[model samples]
Target: MPSAPIKAMIMAAGRGERMRPLTDNTPKPLLKVRGKPLIDWHAEALARGGFTDLVVNTAWLGEQIENHFGQQSQTPPSIAYSREGLDFGGALETAGGIARALPLLGDVFWLLAGDVFVPGFEFTQAAVDRFAAGGKLAHLWLVPNPAHNPKGDFGLGADGLALNLPKDSAEPRFTYSTIGLYRRELFEAMPFGNPQGLKAPLAPLLRAAMDNGRVSAQLYPGPWTDVGTPARLDELNQASTTY
Candidate 1:
């Protein structure tokens, strides 16, 4: 028998406060990047890797997102929505949203923020296989520190473990690419409060896991942009021809 399709979650629930007026009218993930919605790029990559079971958590004008994707059951890569706005009145941050959607996602799933732009990144079955063979709770893709985040987020050891370094530590740190393979246990053990509408950030959970040496990471030396502000979006559009 054929194996089950790998499950993945595309996080689209952010309010995009930095994006401002643009986000006031359009969801960040729906904003055009090279003439296509940002989330579509991730969906296409996951489809290529056979991660057809997808769950998208939405808030902040979520109806637009739902309308764009539609509620189709028989589609090749089936799409499901965890409407946090409708259920909870707002976004559930990152870890909370994932916990809310845990029923749909299985033991392991690919997790990525929908706002970042990484056009050439490929979601490969080989990556899923490698993560499955390991005992780590999460495998994150880290990128060189961007000018906006010079302090970076986490340190990566030569052994592939993610390090939760001290704030003043001079060790090299990298920005989380927000692309990763996750085991459900990372979220399951957390106290997410009431399930009806848990609100929490993902950093604390990731840092705790990192402290325990339960996370792994690798550097991604490729074109990537967080696309947080209007200026960044404009730059991407102006340079669209290069991509």
Candidate 2:
């Protein structure tokens, strides 16, 4: 088995524009997917996979998140927070959020978007081992593009590296599942010390690194859903009850 990451982070700072009303009072990560918080699914899975420490970035009703998980305890991995807007106004976005949390993360850590609902995707030790040995800065899991995002994020090359290409090009593009293993150095260029929040997207950083062949990727065949809107959330809630 490959060595497991010592620390990890879950991106829970989105405003949930499409998940309004439900998110009006609650942060999206705190919203239940099948009787459990979306972030809990990731926390439970990471703990089961031997990850002991977790950092969660929050904004847009972040207090609920900190109050819920901070006041209580989760096993295996003790939980912590990287608040983006206590002094600031809104979220720092993905790259900025991760950069702010860099101090809390280790050299290599696990990262996942808090809102994605992916059932049965395991953080295997073998994948960890493969990444530890590969010397790549990032290891991503790409899934088939969902209807909402027919044009995917990156393409997987024959050499097992991630390639950024236009969806209409000959390369096969897959949607970014928002689950990945990343290195701290990748966010070195992003500012972190400001309380006002460093705002930026994560794609550009990944794309720049891909050009140097520093990112690796693999296709994941599993039940994955990006619960962006209320309609999708209702569908998942209905589907999950059957099982």
Candidate 3:
């Protein structure tokens, strides 16, 4: 088996503007789908999958996230937080948040969104091992386009590299599931803040890497949901009997 990056980071800073009312006080990731918090699924899976260190970035109501897993430090997969808006205010966005958390995240790590529900997806050792051997800057999971986002984000080349081809470019495009494994160097030497953190999105950096043939991808034909809107949340809950 190839070597794997054991540390992981979950993006929990999104304000969830579309999920307001429910997200007004509770962070989107904390909102219950069936009976469990969305982020909890990731936490349990990461721990069960044998990951030893986990970092979570937060902004709006970040303390709740900290409180929920306050004792994780005393356990396995030791948890760390990259709190935003306490000294700076607002979130650091995805890439910015990841950069700020690099000290905890280390050189290579798994990065996943907290709001996405991928119940069957496992934080498998084989996936991590393959990623470490690929020498790529990033690896992403691409899912079939959901209704809310039909145009999709990137295309998968025969070599497994993500391509930023135009929507009509003829290459099959798919939605970014917001789950990835990344190398730290991808965020370095950029016009961005360091320890203090700054506001920025992740897509531009990813596209740049793809241009250099540094990002690979895989098509995940499994259950997944973005949970962006309240109605979508209801649909999930109504469609499920288990949390």
Point to the candidate with the largest lDDT: 1
Q: Tens digit of lDDT per residue, candidate 2, span 133-172?
A: 7789899999999999888999999998999887688877
Worst 10 residues of 1 by lDDT: 69-78
Q: Please, what is the TM-score per model?
A: 0.93, 0.93, 0.93
Task: Give the top-scoring candidate (TM-score).
Answer: 1
Q: Rank order by lDDT, top first? A: 1, 3, 2
What are the per-residue Cα lDDT tens digits for candidate 1 across 1-243? 434668899999999999999999899999989888898888888887778778999999889988787754436467888889988999988988999988888888999999999988888878888888889899999999888999899999999999998767889999999999999889877554337676878899999999999999999999999999999999999983665
Candidate 2, superposed: residue stretches over 4 Å from native: 1-4, 71-76, 192-196, 240-243
Worst 10 residues of 2 by lDDT: 70-79
lDDT of all the models against the reference?
0.88, 0.84, 0.85
Runs with alpha carbons beyond 4 Å of true place in candidate 3 = 1-5, 71-77, 191-193, 241-243
Residue pairs in steric clash, candidate 2? none
Q: What value of lDDT does candidate 2 attain over all alpha carbons? A: 0.84
RMSD to true structure for each model, in Å:
2.3, 2.1, 2.2
